[model samples]
Target chain A: MEQNACCSRREHDLQRRVRAFAEERDWGQFHTPKNLAMALAGEVGELIAEFQWLTPEQSAEVMSDPEAGGRVRAEIGDVMIYLTRLADVLGIDLADAALSKLENSALRYPTDQVRGSAAKR
Target chain B: MEQNACCSRREHDLQRRVRAFAEERDWGQFHTPKNLAMALAGEVGELIAEFQWLTPEQSAEVMSDPEAGGRVRAEIGDVMIYLTRLADVLGIDLADAALSKLENSALRYPTDQVRGSAAKR
Candidate 1:
């Protein structure tokens, strides 16, 4: 019940969709965590490639450009799908993992100390 | 309203949390999409590093080992957080972006064509 507080219904649905999509194609054997992680890394690279040469202003407004926006959205989708699949395969709760990580970050970089600054704590 | 069907409540909450966290620290100026995308790339590298030397089987079972699992979970957290933040900054709906991407992939790599194999389409 406590876990449900953080985990979203659609997140689980997306995970199930990913699982079923792979299952229907008998792709489980190929979806080892290592493989998924590597796939994830490749997707991240592709995602970053979309913003490779853009200025900060351009990067911020990328989604407004039809071609680049489509590419970026597709990459985001690829990244999330792989990430969701990887976490599902590993029995990891993404919401819990992310929230706890944020908590740790908050502690590490207290607002009062880190305000207006980007520095390691 | 239609978007609500795919978007989960907690996903938005997490995005809000990410936004607020940065806002409190005045980190928005530094969170250009390019920077966030690169930061995401770095986090993916860290996630990949967690399984760098592990065999497929080892990678699958890595989460059962507390020490490695903790590190892996933390990396996942970092990756997801950066990803969520990046998507948020771009005004892209993560669920919509990812779901549509999956739909596109289904068309590109039909189950019958790519079943039980890892091949590009």
Candidate 2:
């Protein structure tokens, strides 16, 4: 499959914005891996909060409400932001890591063995 | 800032892997925006589970432990996987969306105003 040149460009683009955002405030000094990881968790919390009380079906439908959809998207964006920042601080290539994981998933849960079964194991 | 060619490549690479995997099981039909969004939320829930009981400081330190770190990494990967899948279904360009968001963030949270304060407000 051909790789999307644009995706790599975007990751690099997000990296710069993240780096510059931190640098402008001299916040680089605070972006320790531990701190960034915590931030990642926190942002994920906010993302989940948007669906805190919804039933499974409702959770699926959470976005049918414009206000809720907007919040979810913002939280999604926040998750992306912190994930990008964490990777930038750790020098991990998110795109590389993501691809590698998917490749591994392909291996771990072979189609013939895992198809029709949603369970991870 | 120069976009990283490699990052985009990885995203495309992941997309192919995702498409191939779903197609193998004929799961494409289930990839509705609502279902994908719900999956995204579920994955984020699992990610948060890794740090649920930890105090703020302990949450930051969660990854210092090898076992905990591995779990966190797995959950993080899961989150990324679902995110990529969701974006793919929605026809959203994660990289482009990410950049546009960062640009917006730069405007909303100006350095001088937000630097000293960690609050999102």
TM-score of chain B of each: 0.93, 0.87
B1-121: candidate 1 lDDT, tens digit per residue? 5455535777877888989999999999999999999999999999999888999999999989999999999999999999999988988888778789888888888888888888776
- Candidate 2 lDDT, A1-121, residue by residue in tens: 3644334545676778778888997777667656666676677667667766766567656666888776766767777888788766644566656666667778888888877766756
What would you estimate as the lDDT of candidate 1? 0.89
- Model 1 residue A10 distance off true place after TM-score fit, in angstroms: 1.2
Regions of candidate 1 where Cα sits further than 4 Å from its true position: A1-6, B1-6
Q: Give the alpha carbon lDDT tens digit for every residue of B22-107 in model 2.
A: 88866676676556656776776676676567665675566678887766666667767777776666455666666666777888
Residue A71 error for model 2, in Å? 3.0
